[model samples]
Target: DASAMDKKQKQFDKLINEWKQKCEDITVELEASQKESRHYSTELFKLKTQYEESHEQIEALRKENKNLAEEIKV
Candidate 1:
């Protein structure tokens, strides 16, 4: 009976060790993904700002063209 109990305890310990190892792996992977996402977000913000600036410049050019047309009519 004592040997059977020891064997059962060893199996339980092995399972617990495997579970802990898997949890550590998952935590590491999550941290890596979070870091990559943050980097992408920063790049997206910069690109968005550049797009907005270019759009404003285009609007200004259009207005200038309209003013020139009016001058020609007058």
Candidate 2:
């Protein structure tokens, strides 16, 4: 009975160690995922800002062209 209990204890310890390692690995992976998410989010924001600015520029150019056309007609 004593030997069996000792063997069981050893097996339990081994399983605990394995679980601990797996938990650490998962933590590292989660941190990496968060970092990548932040990077992509910043990039997306920059692109959106650029798109808005370009749209404004196009509208301004169109208005200028219309004004010039009217001036020539006069």
Candidate 3:
């Protein structure tokens, strides 16, 4: 009975260690994914700002072109 109990205890310990390692690995992966998400989010924000600025510049240029055309007709 004692030997059987000892074997069971060893098996339990092995399982516990394996579970702990799995938890650590999952935590590491979660952190890496979060970091990647933040990087992409920042890039997206920068691109959106750049697009807005470019759109404004294009609109301004169009207005200027129309005025120049009208002046030439006059």
Clash count of each predicted structure = 0, 0, 0
1-74 in candidate 1: lDDT tens per residue?
99999999999999999999999999999999999999999999999999999999999999999999999999
Measured over all alpha carbons after superposition, the RMSD of each candidate to the real structure, in angstroms, is 1.2, 0.8, 0.7
Q: Give the number of the best model, judged by TM-score.
A: 3
lDDT assessment of candidate 2? 1.00
Ranking by TM-score: 3, 2, 1
Model 1 accuracy (lDDT, Cα): 1.00
Q: How far is candidate 2 from the true structure (C-alpha RMSD, Å)?
A: 0.8
lDDT of 1 at 59: 100
Model 3 C-alpha lDDT per residue in residues 1-74, reported as the tens digit of each score: 99999999999999999999999999999999999999999999999999999999999999999999999999
Residue 22: error of model 2 in Å? Answer: 0.9
Give lDDT per model, in order: 1.00, 1.00, 1.00
Q: Candidate 1 or 2, higher TM-score?
A: 2
- Candidate 1: residue 28 lDDT (0-100): 100
Clashing residue pairs, backbone N/CA/C < 3 A, model 2: none
Candidate 1, after superposition: displacement of residue 69 in Å? 2.3
In candidate 2, residue 29 scores what lDDT? Answer: 100
TM-score for each candidate, following the candidate numbering: 0.87, 0.93, 0.95
lDDT for each residue of candidate 2 in 1-74, tens digit (9 for 90 to 100): 99999999999999999999999999999999999999999999999999999999999999999999999999
lDDT for residue 68 in candidate 3, whole number 0-100: 100
